[model samples]
Target: MTRKRVLCISYQFPPFAGTGVFRVLNFVEHLPDRGWDPVVLSVLPGHYERGTALDDGLCARVNGSARVHRTKCFQGIDAMLSLRGTFRGNATPASAGQGETAGTAPAGKGFWQGVKDAVTLAYRIPDKQVGWLPYALAEGVRICRHEKPELIYASGGPWTSFLIGLALKAHFHLPLVIDFRDPWMNNPYDELNVGFRRRVNRFLERWCLRRADAVIANTEPLRTLLADTAGSGNKCHTITNGYNETEYVGLKARASGTVPLVVTHVGNLYGKRTPDSFLQALTRLIDTGRLGVHEVAVRFIGHVDEARINNLIGSHPVSAMVTCVGVVPKNQALKMLFQSDIALLIQPDTRLQIPAKLFEYIRSQKPILAVCGEGATQELIEAHGLGVVADADDPEGMEGAILDVFRQARSAEGHVKKDYMAFEAGALTTQLAGVFDGVFQSSPQMKNG
Candidate 1:
């Protein structure tokens, strides 16, 4: 069978550790098995901010046959400052300021930082990563001219990648599929500048959706939201994030006799998703003698605000029991998940979003204690009988769920198993392939392109 070639425009790719990278990586890895050839076009390393340590292991996981093209983007303000210092033979103003670190904002520049942030926000349309759009588009066009790919798959935000897909669709008349890792204009967290900026985003989103051959959302709700926003439900499809079981090969689950129930969370926390509520629950459990301070350990293993977490823990009696391991390698984090008695999943108030970490926790086979509002996360937990879900705002409910899991751990029945075959990466990739097939077969432009 002749495999259809797909040009994948992803801003975040392997060696750069992020939740965004895995979806593209898994898709590219499994696409070949489903009769598709992926040509990845990604930004070169060091162009973007690093949230976690790079994992070369993930880079190695990309299919050997896929041709990956890495390109450089225009440098950011901080990088330009460093370059100016190098040429001038003096410390940059940002670096020379008292308590100002090399890469971070100054300690006393709250006002200046706010001004700079506002300026950047006002200038950068869609996202700060928009600076990479021109370079990515140039390289993408160059590749299309030579490779003549049948389809363009652009994963976003840095929603700029979708713009690149839009441009490619115009230039080559290829079938452009925009993958929304998260909602664009409808994203609850984004602080879009009112008036002109917000209007531009809305226009850009509508324009892209109108031109897209198909749109892929990670959840059904997101698909519906995008379809409704675009006023076109014909091209929208849901393909949820999933786990690659092959990564867990040769890793043993936590031994049954391990003492001190270990509850582990393994991802970044931002916005409304914080450890305060969970910390409060732990405090209640310890105060009530339901859980011993020494008998329960809560471990955090990713990019987290240390000061904020410490402040939250300071008010709690179980302060010593909470440990933030910071960010570790992907395998090391997985090992922590494997050895955990219960995997902790914290969801914010957003009902439209689902964290990719839940699927990984499911892969751990450890019971999950999801602190979430009523949404996809809670629905998946209940549907799969994965574990207990407590409202994020309900401390008493959270405490009760934790206690139930603790009791189950004591009885060696805490590990809840579910049929995860459908959530596996390979299976999800096959479903995505089916969508690609459907779009290609149904679209007049795709058939003619």
Candidate 2:
């Protein structure tokens, strides 16, 4: 059988460690098995923003037949600042992990810093990664001319990837598929607060949606929102994030009641996803002597803002019960989750977004104590009997949920109930392949070409 070719443009790919990289990586790894050869176009590693960890293990997972082309990005403000500092003999090499660097801060202390910060924020109209577009587009066009792939697939929040796909479609007349790992204009954590900028983003989103041959949303709620906005429900489809079952193979589940009830949260907290309510609830339970501090322990194992977490914990008397493990390797993190008595799934109030971490949590077979809003995460937990769910904003509910999970742990009945076979990456990859097949067969351009 002749294999179809898919040109995938994604700014987030391995060896970058984060939830963002897994979707495309899995697609690349499994597409060939489904009769599609994936050609990936990604930004060069050095061009990535500082503090993004390089996961070599993920890089090794790419299929040998899949061709990955990494191109250089024009130096952004941080890179420029670092260059100038180097020329002046005063700069250290930038860290290789995710977060803002010192160069991204204000040019000076106090007022000057505020002014510089404002300018920088404004300059990042769509996103800070906009600087990568020119390089990505150049590489994309070059690849299209050489390989002439049947379709172009772009995944984002460098949302620049979609722009590249759009440009490639316009230039080559190839069908384009844009995947939304998160909503563009409706993003709850969008830092672009200016009314005009927000309007610009909305316009851009609509423009892209109209031109793309198909849209892939990682969640059903997101697909509905995108379809509603684009006024083309037929063009949108939902293909959620899933865990690679191979990762969990041979990993033993933690024996119950062997340790303190370890409730583990395995990602960063920001915006509405903070642990303020959870901390407050823990504090109240401790203060009221409803739950012993020594009976339960909370572990955070990723890149969370320490100051914010510290402030929340310090306000409560449950400080001794919490451990912030910073970040660890993906394998180690998975092991931590497997050993955990309960997994923490914190969701923002937005109904359109679900953290990609939930599938991994489910795969661990560890019960989830979800402090979330009314959204897919909550629905999934309730539907699957995956454990307890509570509103992130409700201290009483959160406290009750936590206490319940702790009680279940004490009784050795805290394991996750449902088998999430549908969420296995291999199966989900087949669904993605079906989407690609449908899009390819229906596209007049592909048929003609």
In the order shown, the candidates' Cα RMSDs to the true structure are 4.8, 6.0
Per-residue lDDT tens digits for candidate 1, residues 1-449, read 76788999998898777788899899999999898999999988867664445767777887495899988776465554455446546656655576755799656457655655665665558776777888898899899999988788999877889999999888887888999998777677876645677788888998988889899989877888899877899889889999998879887887875888898999988888887888888888888888787798889898788899777767566878888898787788998889888899988776777889889988888888888888777888888888888876777788888888777776656754668878899999998898888777766665565
Clashing residue pairs for model 1: none
Q: Give the runs in model 1 whose Cα sits over 4 Å from its true position.
A: 49-53, 76-118, 192-195, 306-310, 313-317, 411-413, 445-449
Worst 10 residues of 1 by lDDT: 76-85
- In candidate 1, position 238 carries an lDDT of 88
**Local accuracy of candidate 2 as per-residue lDDT tens digits, 213-235:** 89999888789889988789998
Q: Which segments of model 2 are wrong by more than 4 Å?
A: 79-123, 305-317, 410-413, 446-449
Deviation in angstroms for 265 in model 1? Answer: 1.2
For model 2, state the Cα shift of residue 229 in Å: 1.4
**lDDT at residue 206 of model 1 (Cα atoms):** 89
Kindly report which residue pairs in candidate 2 clash with one another: 51-97, 51-98, 52-97, 52-98
